[model samples]
Target chain A: MAYERKIGDTILSVDQISLAFGGVKALSNISFSVNQHEVFAIIGPNGAGKSSMLNCINGFYHPQEGTITFKGNTRRHVRPSEAAREGIARTFQNIALFKGMTTLDNIMTGRNTKMHKNIFWQALRFGPAEKEEMEHREVVERVIDFLEIEAIRKTPVGTLPYGLQKRVELGRALAAEPDLLLLDEPMAGMNLEEKQDMCRFILDVNDEFGTTIVLIEHDMGVVMDISDRVVVLDYGKKLADGTPDEVRSNQAVIDAYLGVAHDDAEE
Target chain B: MFYREAGQFKTSYRADQGILTIVQDRFVIGAFAFVAFCVVPFFINDYWANAILIHVLVYVLAALGLNILTGYCGQVSLGTGGFMAVGAYASYKLITAFPEMNFIVAILMSGGITAAVGVVFGLPSLRIKGFYLAVATLAAQFFLVWVFNKFGWFFNYSPTGMIVSPPREVFGFLVTGPQASPEARYLFCLSFVVVFALAAKNIVRGRVGRSWMAIRDMDIAAELIGIRPLEAKLTAFAVSSFYIGVAGALYFNVWLGSAEPTEAFDINQSFFVLFIIIIGGLGSILGSFLGAAFMVLVPITLKTVMVDGFGFAVGAAKHAEVMLLGTLIILFLIVEPHGLARLWQILKEKLRRWPFPY
Candidate 1:
């Protein structure tokens, strides 16, 4: 089947992306697109190259054969910093907040790509540099307030509870002011209450900023509940892509998750 | 209640984002600055000023440099002395080649030279990290020291493989060679240390600093967040080596008045600086200064007590001093892996809630 895709409406267009390490191919010609301001979810079984897709999109990994076009910038080879500069921000599969630094400082680091002051200005820490820092601080403080981590602003992130640490990581990604946000398992290891809270924040972030969200999630319920569109993958290949309901009914998607039938049907 | 920030409203973002939002921290920092720059100089005698304060100042600068690499960036380097030797020898050559050039310019030029060399050694960090990277830097230490000792030109072609200091002056006042007063040297070293320390703090708290911390905390994550590991890591090396080189120049031109490659750029200097950072606090600017002071003062105090005061033999006292230093290092690591800096932080926290132990 063939379908027409809108140009400007698509925030990220990945065409025939493949990545291989030595003898084993981690991802084989995976292709997908996320629409602007839409909540897109990539769901697959373990080792289905879900994280690898996000990594390639964010420039952590360069695909051997593919084109990743984001916000009008097309590149065969793109660096992570360049991806970030092009308004792409991502949280890690594992929490990666600077352990030795405070939550506020960790969030502040997210503003680093935007900070323009030189070394001399920073050293003096007065005039334009101080003004810039204050502006960044205000943004970071707003994030802290939004996440309800105000009390732990000065506390080192390493000492924080897992849920709060995840919140802090979200705040950091927000600090980048990204057009497309890649969140990898934001509610991976959380209680029901924490999961609900994170879901609310994610919805708020999407609604308030109109940021395009791409996420890799294991929880089918959460994925179906929040996602506007879903892409299912199996064995380093795209199994199906459409509205959540459309993918939910697709036989290939079901087969990927429930396993292929053996000998027609079970007795 | 007095430390509360309830009534101190921030009318602007500038007011809200200050390093010290509370009045108490501002007052303390102000008082501490006054003591360091004004009060301490009056009480410090010529001998202590020359031998102790000057030494402390020099080590402080070097520690700040090493702290940028090992502390802020999380790239554990064991080659501080080698970088420092590059500075000292570079400075020696600069002065010898251009005898009439300003002494300050020569020292800074030496720093530039060291930065170049540091970036060269730092290239290996792109592919290696942690223990393996540390070993790579150790190679820089051994290789550089060998070059300096083997090449006569580094020492101004001196027959004995040592560069004797030439008489140098700053704005009419003699500041180099043996004739320079300790007060002059102290002021000189103090000014550079203060400027560079402030610079280091700014860099660490700014964009470059964030990139470094990001790389240190998680390289994969940092890349995803838009920081190039190569750019950040190399910048750290260049900046760190620049400061270390300046400290080395001062160590030779001002402190020693004569420099040998082995003495100026030896591996022991690297250990000494590394120990200062470890015992003070890794990744802390204040910790660097505190660590340097502790490293410098403890041995002098031990020597005084064991030899001069108690009349022990010189050799015996020296041995005791080394043993004591080793024991203190182990003790500090065991008691607080973060070092004396964490101890100071704990004390401050305790005092913040004083007269009522929660």
Candidate 2:
């Protein structure tokens, strides 16, 4: 609410990232930056190293040569956990929700960084631990409401339908109150209704939380509708980067999309 | 319709997050504790106390430990007996080394020491999981027993090569050694069961517990979600070992009073606790208690029936008991791999949805 629909200074920058797996370059000299309170989408075919770029941003993969800067903190070697603590949260393309746990528990786990109770307090489960848990429970409950997944709050995520599971995964990432939310195919495998719901939640999160978002999606209409800036990747190289219309109309992106003529989706 | 929470309303987050939210569940738990604390101590004699209750309680604590690691964290440890031995030896050394040490402090220190050792053995878990991790824990079990057996210092150089729990008083009540009364010893061990059980309940209800469960379900996802695997796994090992350590100390100080390492904490003992978790239920605190009871009672019942009710020899009855127990454990695994806990849960769920035909 503080900055309504405003995309500010760069919150995250990836410079000269080149990730290779033993002589195979997965990404070659890739670079991109996402602004504050903006929805940035990375688009490419399956092997465009799009997911690899997101991984490098979150410190899951240390690119052979590059620096990832987040919230004014830049580093080459930082743990994924450190990235999380620094308020960078992410979801997986494959829906990495803790399967056996309840939806509420899965989201509350995302609040682990905010919970500071030590083992002694936790062992007692009174005083600070109880108070801390109550505080976070409210937050998680709100997330459940926002995602409209109140019915599955107590059900194990493994037992839920795929679309609801993806919603729960987003609920988990959002529970972190992250500065930059990286969603790897948040709408993957979703039908039209689910995709619409996910798009709404993503827009709501960016607007209400004033959170920066970097997501990778295969759906063209969803991407053009939501993403403020689009990064097109092809064979581990940054092909084009601009607003939705600019990238959509670019010849290279058109050719890269392989003449499917997705530029019409912007209409 | 019988098991309903219809009238019980929780308006606050605190009430909503209770260990047992339902009014009937709390009432049942309260009644159980009341009987254990007030009623059973008065009616129990030496035969019942030593033969069943104390053994069950100590194993309850140890089972809780293994359950936390293997059940909650999904680490699948087979070294509970070894960790318990570490606790027993540590307590012996602490008490014998300093006679003036308070029994409670001595017990806690023993658990702390065992926790340290547990963390060491838990390192292999980072590199391996499932059966291989279990084998690593088994190695820990053997190595700890060997250390206690080979070293004279653990046994205080006694010719028997065994450590004996010296007489110790808690609040002027003799609770250890030969001179202690069954009621006092039983009460002391029960106190441990009550306190640690509460602590375990609390731990499992909080963030630490969630992290363990998260790690159990999926380690990579857990790590990405900011649940540190090293911290979560090691803490599970340390805390679980602490519970098992206290159980071991109580086993030595209050239950057995003295014991040789090899006989006391063997691979069979490890299997015994493992069976308790498997039979009782993995990842259910209630399962550990159910497991301990099932583990302790049925065999004693079998042995007694074979030897006393029938005309079988004591040794023959023991063999028959072992065979019967093996069969029962297999039957339990086949019937409900989640253990009695899941069965109990199914019953409760059915009860909640009662008055309607299936």
Candidate 3:
């Protein structure tokens, strides 16, 4: 199903970002922007500094030279918490769900930002904390319902299937209600059915919530099917930036990311 | 069938969401509270009240503290003895300096002091974890004990180098000192334990608890997810120390009446609380009580059987008791790693499956 994306002003942009460890460059003068309510894809072969670009955006890594502009406000560094506070929530490349916690608790944890009660109230858990928890719990329950993970609400994430664990992680990020959601390989290790489910959810999250998404997915087919725009990274550099069809037809992207043999065979 | 919840469905969120969700669980907790507050105080002899009941209550408080840190928060600290020492000394100071101070105020002040010390000791946790953090916390244990042992001001320069709790009253009832009856002291400690346990349960069931667990599971991810690791770990340390501190205050003021550093807040106290959580079930509030109970009773029972049933010498029986307790703990853990809590859960499950396989 085609999920229409209403393009708006740029929600996030990177300007001439170059990150390196000692002399080895991880990302070199790479720049791309995510427009509001757009499903933006960052696709690259393995070791193409795809994750590094995400790290820079989220403030986990401080680039030697770069400016990150989020909501038209540019800054030298955006700390992860700062980014989260400013409505940038992310899922990890490797599912980082709290393994010991139930799916509900893990999602509720994402509501940490909205919870205003302090230790005094939390310790009592009657007046303020209970009220806040229940209120946030309503939002989390909605996320769980939307994701169709109601059955695993009480189950620990450690025991869940890999695909479900990924979904729970997504739920956790969504529970935060960020304006821009960063999903790093959200459906990395999943069967075709699971991937389809994840794809539909991602599209629905974008379409229904009108959330701008920055997605890093290796699967070109899924990326092309869902993302409104594609940014191809190769050798720590921006290779191509356009719509999926334009990126698909780019010779450099086909050779560096899609493989020359595959492209020729397809042609 | 009696254990089954087939007809006890929750009709409200409050009913469904609580420390005791099942109706049977609520009943069990209610019954236990009644037995503790009303029945035990009336029936227990001085020996049971002073030597056993009060001691168990105090240890339960301490174990609850340690479990929150090591069990739930995943920040291991071998500083229970040290933190408790902070509480003991702080309470002693508060009691001695302000003779007009209420016992409750002194205990709370001591908890605050210990929380400060705990936060200081906990700072390194942000930079380190696992055994290294454990080893670093041991420094706090050794240093705190040494501070109390070496400093005359701590004990008020008493020739015996021990601090004695002055007599204090709560609501026209003697709660501390030699004049206090066993029941007075027992009730005092019991009240504190019950309150602390409730607060602990409440905290762990809510936002603070989730943040601590998130940091425990994955600190990096927790940070990215907006949980401040520094805040979470330090809060764990502060809160854990606060409870342990109150236990120390009770241990000195109500139970022992006088505390010598080596004899009172030693490394053994730390290991004992660690064993409590291991035997009770880590990350479960009910485990703290069960573990403390198991630890307190098993030793006394072993000693009684060794001395009476076997005609062993008192010293030999003491040694034999320790060995037997050790053996039992090992066997119990080997059989069910989640401890007595898991055992109780298993029993409940079996009861639910009465007359049929589940």
Index of the highest-lDDT prediction: 2
Residue-pair clashes per prediction, in order, are 0, 0, 0
Q: Which ten residues in a row have the lowest lDDT in candidate 3 chain A?
A: A258-267
DockQ result, candidate 3: 0.76
Candidates in descending lDDT order: 2, 3, 1
> Model 1, A1-267: lDDT tens per residue?
022222239878999999887776878888888889888999999888899888888888888998988887777688888888789998877898888778888888889888888777887887888888888888888888888989998798899999999999999999999999999999999999999999999888888778889998999999999888999877688889999999999998887788766733211
lDDT string for model 1 (B96-191, tens) is 899989999999999999999999999999999999999999999999999999987677677899887798998787878878876677778888
Query: What would the per-residue lDDT of candidate 3 be over residues B43-89, giving only the tens digit for each residue?
Result: 87779987689989999999999999998899998999989999999
- TM-score (0 to 1) of chain B, per candidate? 0.94, 0.97, 0.98
Against the true structure, whose DockQ is highest?
A: 3
Residues A1-267, model 3: lDDT tens digits = 554457899999999999999988999999888899999999888878889988888888989898999998898786677778788899999888899999999998999877878888988888878888888888998999999999999998999999999999999999999999999999898999999999999999998999999999988789998988999998798999999999999998878854676344322
lDDT of each: 0.87, 0.90, 0.89
Better of 1 and 2 by lDDT: 2
| Model 2 quality (TM-score) | 0.96
Q: Write the per-residue lDDT of candidate 2 for residues B21-140, one digit (tens) a residue.
A: 998898999999899889998898888989899999999999999999998999988898899999999999999999999999999999999999999999999899999999999999
Q: Provide the DockQ value for model 1.
A: 0.67
Off by over 4 Å in 1: A1-8, A22-25, A260-267, B1-32, B39-46
